[model samples]
Target: MLINLWYVAEWSKTVKDKPVKAKVLGQNLVLFRDLEGNVKCTADVCLHRGGSLSNGWVNKKRDCVVCPYHGWEYNGEGKCTKIPSEGDDFKVPPRFKVDAYPVEERYGMIWVFMGDLDEKDRYPIPPLPEYDDPNFRGLETEFTWQAEASRVVENGIDIAHASFVHPVFGYPDTAEDNYIESIEKHEEWAVSHNVMYPPQLKGGFLGWRKLIRKDKQPTVVHPGWYLNGMTVKIQIDLRKDWKIVMFDANTPVDEHTTRTFAWQFRSFMKSPLFDKGSLKRLSTILHEDAQIVEASQPYYLPETLANEVSVKSDKFMSTFRMARRRCIEELGWQIDLDKRDSYNGKKVLTIPSPGRKEALAEGRGWVFETMPLVAPVKTPTEKKDFEKQVDELTVDQLNSKDNVIG
Candidate 1:
């Protein structure tokens, strides 16, 4: 996993008032929502002791998270507010805080910058405009594959794979003829505008023969790949009234593990039934790809072109490989390929997340120790400042002529 890019940590719905564990770019972190409704991402280990913060809970006012081991409190900004070990009056040093990655919640998934903060904005999570379309219903999906993040990302933008991996919309014969009409390459991403001809659509589960205008409409697809964790595949049908857009955000759990967060949007899927059906179909299709990907040789993507074979149809994948090579060579964002792993008896390369270094640095950081289990004390504050604000909003809502509450 390369640094300086946003990776999906987890789904927003999974994170509640209690802290939850999420691994991205090989670093274990915790996520939770404060009373203000803002999501907070912090190093899982407590700064004082090595207690995992995910095993902790929120404070009385829901202002900060309290550690289970020593009751060290950290706010949404990742600053230690209260250290129970020291008296409440003892002010915690500024440096006595866990590392907090820049995070934002977008399209139902929490994204975090696992690299330098300066580059966070340079590579914001790829946008999914289809999710906001008023005419389209949402089809959300997620899957975990035992594959490297790089391989997971590359396969997402590889059009050739759909022919063989996903037989519903494509065939093996056309997989070799997947010619790239054009490719736009940038420093951080690559866009492939290609053509896909789904041979005579026979009646099946999708029933594309009747849904489409013609027996086989040449679909033009533009797949954009951001080397980090986001990809978008947009298919435009000229004769049809609707379009299909698939968005994916792939996060790395470890060197050989990847968790994918995805969504399928259709201009015609306005009903909830279609939304559910599309999501179900998408799950099956992705698992098919996973089966092929897990058995893939040389788990890690090869940096050198000579290490693997390539063809003209591999234009997009090739560009990603070149850009990935630059990240490994010039950007100093690489992994140690010599670390022995218990899986498969072969060493898998693993990159050191900068987030982990900052978490373990001076001033102490999140705890990594497995201390004795302890329960958190919940002392909900009696109608306080936040409740007062809520009361004011409630009054304003009641006084308003419109029935809608603000």
Candidate 2:
């Protein structure tokens, strides 16, 4: 994961008056809303005895989070305000604080700055203009993948795979048919447009019936720029009056882990009842993509185009990979080549660390590099239990941020 970027920590409703745990870019953070209802995020570790603050509670009156172990209270600013062990008259040193991260509440998600707070504004979160349109309605879903963030984002944007991996979105008959009209790549972002003849379900209920029984559709796919960045969008026409957009906010939990929050926005179906069915179908389609992505090779992404084969239909995907490579090679972001064994293709376990940021003087530019250690995964024996895998999308991820498994 890169620094100076915004990553979804948790959905807004998930972080209410209670401290909630989330991990982004390998940082364990606790989120809670203050008295004013503004969200605040900080390192989950207690400054004193290394206790977890997520195991704590919110002090409603003081608008602070109280540590469960010793009742140490820290406010939104991350300043230690009260130490129950100390007498009321004892002055809590101003220097006693936890690492506070910048946070924003947008699109029903709580986003946190996973880098230097000063750099947050430079890389703004992707805007959703459709959200402001009264006629548009949507729902959000979250999923965790045992794959790298780059691979997960690539899966969402890949046009060719729709035919093979996602049967619901692409017909098996048109699996060999491919089309890509145009692609544009910028310094910070990139856009690719493709002409697609998608395969739809032949006969089904409301929306599905309309799509399949109608004329064989040739649609356009307008994908957002900067494929490897925090946001990815796929705008495709579902019908003349109704268009569907799948906007994904991809976050790296660690080197080989990802958190994806997708917003399925449709301009035509404004009814909430209809949207519920759409979300279920969309969630299932995305899960199909996940199964294939988790099985990809060279987990950290191949170093160059030479590392993998490509064709004409892969133009947009290739561009995204090129831009991502530039950031890793030219810019400071790097991949941990040593973490994976060359002979056996096995990943070694190591304690994960956050990315480091390097900046030029006078705000010229900056680069964030991976710290190189793989995030720790608990062996199943350690916990003596494995949580049941929930295939359906839920308010929270199928796997809560707290549980770790081998």
Candidate 3:
């Protein structure tokens, strides 16, 4: 998993008076709302006796998480304010603190930055304007996949698979007719417009929905991906006025498990009465997708394309891979899972949050070692060559008219 990006920790409503436990990028974290109703997140491991802060309760009087083991109180900034054994007159040392992450609430989800990058250098969270717009009716749902988060993201944006996997969206016979219309690329995100022929909407009351589109009607869809939150957004234009948009934030609970927090918004279905069918169809689509994604080979995304073959239809997905590759190779954010697994239960390592980074800069020692990262590609020549390869992947190679893709 890569660091220095925002990941959804939990639903905003879930974190109330009590502390909640969250796992992201394989590190355990504790989240709780303060007296002001602002959510705060910190490393779950307590500095005192290695206790779990999440297992404790929120001390409302002090606006802190009270460690159940020793009653050590940690505030929003993670400084240990009180130790019951030490008594009220004793002052806790400044160094007695835990790693605290930056947290924010948007679109009803709690997002935490799982790295040490300052606010200026961090990628902004993807905006979902539809979530707040009154013109759209929104429904929220969540799913967990026993697969890599990257795989889940790629599957969400893989338009070609809709034909074979989701009969409600496309037909296997019409898969060949699907084509990408245009693509827009950015350093941290990419968007693509595509055209597909799918069956008409089914199961509306009295078959009224069949009039929305004909069987095998051509539809336009725009799929986009953002590095922050590992988010995938797909907007389908059913017609000029009617549209369906899905925004999914896929979180890597670990290297092997991904939890998807999804929201579906529709322009035509404005009534709450239609929610049952809409949700049922959404559930069905997710189940269909899980069947294929979980069984894919290699388990995780490949470091390079050498072991895999990409067709023209995979060009959009390739952009995501290459963007993630840059973060791993040049930015050096990808975690060294192999090295981490070697430590196993012998050691406790946490992701370096901004607080930890600042403390270390000031010569304050920490109790746990930061998680190891994959070594970045060293040397200016190698960096240039890697950039050239990325350009080729995006321009010359992927843009080729041939059916084969590099």
Candidate 4:
């Protein structure tokens, strides 16, 4: 896994005046908001006694983090500002400091770099689509589950598992052949996987309903990584108003745990009743997927030894692993030499394209230059007109048809 790149630590709203602990790619970090309202990430270990800084409280007056065990206070720059037992005239040791990482806030999330400060800007966070659209309503949710970071990510790109492990949560009824259209790599910082979800059995009650209405849809899954690690961004585009959902899973805890953040963007609804009902339905579906992911045992595996055979649907996963290996090598991260040799035996694996050099150079500050900003289709004019009427409709009229009762 690539280190020193920014990974989403928590939703921006969740980090307030309190301190929280986040682990990025196996590095434990203490995150807190200073009195000035700036977020910071520092090595969780106290310099004096190795006590976890996360166990301490934020001192608003001096804008420092006060270690609970020894009264050692550390500022945002990781320098010790106060040592309670020492006399005012006593000089603090020059080495009395904790390591700090660069942090930034965007898209309602806090992203932290987990490596040397000199390499901070080399890898950037990937840009998101929802940030620019006002009509898009964003709903964010988090899930804490026991799983390895790689396994959790592989699950996100595994289109075939939907029919089996997540059949009820709007996964297509049948597994259809899919292929990797293209893969964009960013050195050790990130990889963008573009997968085409071909027309298949649109399962789920919602699918049946759409079928009754003579609507058919195709989906594309765009998964990306940021901050040189396994944090995953999954964007799904369904053709209707309530069709798109974006999921960002940050493995900020460790190899055995993950903090999954999901965001749903629904186009303006014509009816408040429909909006509320849609939220509930989507939330339930997400929870179902969570349950399955949480239940998988031994979530992390050496990909070289995976018993599963690859098919057309697995192209993205296979390509992702190849890109990940190249990144690990490029960043000089440690690798199991045996596994490297084994993977080399298979000719199907290949390194990421060199074209990624330009994109990776743009890094974290890359702006979106493409359009169809919202889905290409505009809402029906009649539907927009009906929005006000539906808003004013009686409860009886709204509840006359129950989309959830099924």
Per-candidate TM equals 0.80, 0.78, 0.94, 0.68
lDDT of 3: 0.88
Per-candidate clash tally: 7, 3, 0, 4
Off by over 4 Å in 1: 119-121, 202-209, 213-216, 230-238, 337-406
Ranking by lDDT: 3, 1, 2, 4
Question: Candidate 1 residues 183-233, lDDT tens each?
Answer: 776666767787786665445366754555443357777787776574545
Candidate 4 at residue 219, lDDT?
56
> For residues 1-406, could you state the per-residue lDDT of candidate 2 as single tens digits?
5655678888888877789988876667889898889998877777777778899999969488889989999887666899987889989875566666678888888888765435523467777777667767877887788998888877777888887887655766875665666665555466677777765544336456564324447777787644333578888875576678878888888766788887888886476867667777888887898889888887766645444455555556655664565455444444344543342223222112221121233332312122353332322221112112212223232122421110
Total residue pair clashes for candidate 4: 4
Kindly report which residue pairs in candidate 2 clash with one another: 171-199, 190-225, 190-226
Name the candidate that leads on TM-score: 3
Rank by TM-score, descending?
Answer: 3, 1, 2, 4
Model 2 lDDT-worst window of ten: 382-391
Candidate 4, superposed: residue stretches over 4 Å from native: 117-121, 168-174, 177-216, 220-229, 240-243, 268-298, 305-308, 334-406
- Model 2 TM-score (2 dp): 0.78
Candidate 3 — which residues are off by over 4 angstroms? 378-406
Residue range with the least summed lDDT across 10 consecutive positions in model 4: 366-375
**Which candidate model has the greater TM-score, 1 or 3?**
3
Winner by TM-score between candidate 2 and candidate 1: 1
The local distance difference test score of model 4 is 0.55
